[model samples]
Target: MFTNPEQFANATKTLFELQMNTFNALTSKAVDGVEQVIALNMATAKNSVKGSVDAGMELSQAKDPKAAMDTAASQVQPAVGGAVAYGEQLKVIIEDIHKEFTEAADHHMAEAKNTLSALIYDVTKNVKPGSENAVDVIKAAIDNAFKGYEEVTRATREAVKTVEQEIAKATAQVGALKPAPKNEAAE
Candidate 1:
């Protein structure tokens, strides 16, 4: 449908560049997310190691077995709390990445749509008189494709919302849990 070789070449080059840019943006976002996750894990691990060492030292200082057991039991609640906090932090990071990806994709899709429309317009400019029908058909097909893409994008957003709600509910349930009493006598 291109009017000339130069137009076709330019269109191809523009589309290819758009695709490459999109790929690079997405890959960079993924790498940043991975780095954030790794950093979070490293910090968590370091804290966990320190906590264990401190607990061990405390237990060792206890004069009797009962005291040692009590000390160990007392550490359980904080440990559980730490785990819950870690889960919350991880969830935040994941959500951030999802948001960034969605925004970037939306931006690129808009750019691609504009580029395609321009190319189509240019091609249609040189259409032969008898080729009006073909041009109309191409326009209709492109419109339908755009509509389909919009529908899918909406559905995906809704699905992500549902998943986020479920995660929040689960997190709340975990946070609501109460640690076991160390000694019934003390309670």
Candidate 2:
């Protein structure tokens, strides 16, 4: 029990500040992710332009139809490889951001639960005689709420894991389907 109103107010202010700090950290992470994406895009665009120019020059110098076809075939494997690498990098960035956000949120939730529990315990301790049953009921209710929250969080984590596994399987299949070097060599 907070015997003093000032003490309660101070606790409230501290909680508010903690929330603001968490929010700012999340915002900074989001901005950093965006910057990384933009930088990747810019570099990809520059490389693409350079590749196009170089390929054009090579194609122009081709001695015949076979040479032209060979030049074009050589570009395919590199382009496909670059695309796959880019996708993997982008996925990593997204996962990192999500991981940070989840950790921060979990930390905040735990802090809040502890604070509330402590406050409840203090209040119940200071209560008049014959209020033990009421305190028990309050504690039970809080326990049930925590149990429900834990179940939901577990379910959500399992779903996310399932999705990630599916994505990984699909990516593996796509990689396996890459054009065989033997076929490209035959060209």
Score every model by TM-score: 0.77, 0.66
The residue-by-residue lDDT of candidate 1 on 77-144, one tens digit each, is 88889878977987898798879878976887797789778877876888998888877876676566
Cα lDDT for residue 167, model 1?
65
Please report the TM-score between candidate 2 and the true structure: 0.66
Residue-level lDDT for 152 in candidate 2: 51
* Weakest ten-residue segment in model 2 by summed lDDT: 148-157
Best by TM-score: 1
Please, what are the lDDT tens digits per residue for candidate 2 over residues 1-187? 4456785576567556655665676568668868887887788788888988999999999999999998998888877776666667666765775686567657756865786577566656676677778667756755665565456546645655665566566557667657777654664
Any runs in candidate 1 off by more than 4 Å, and if so which?
131-186
Q: List the pairs of residues colliding in candidate 2.
A: 1-122, 1-123
Backbone clash pairs for candidate 1 read none
Instruction: Please report, in order, the local distance difference test score of every candidate based on alpha carbons.
Output: 0.79, 0.68
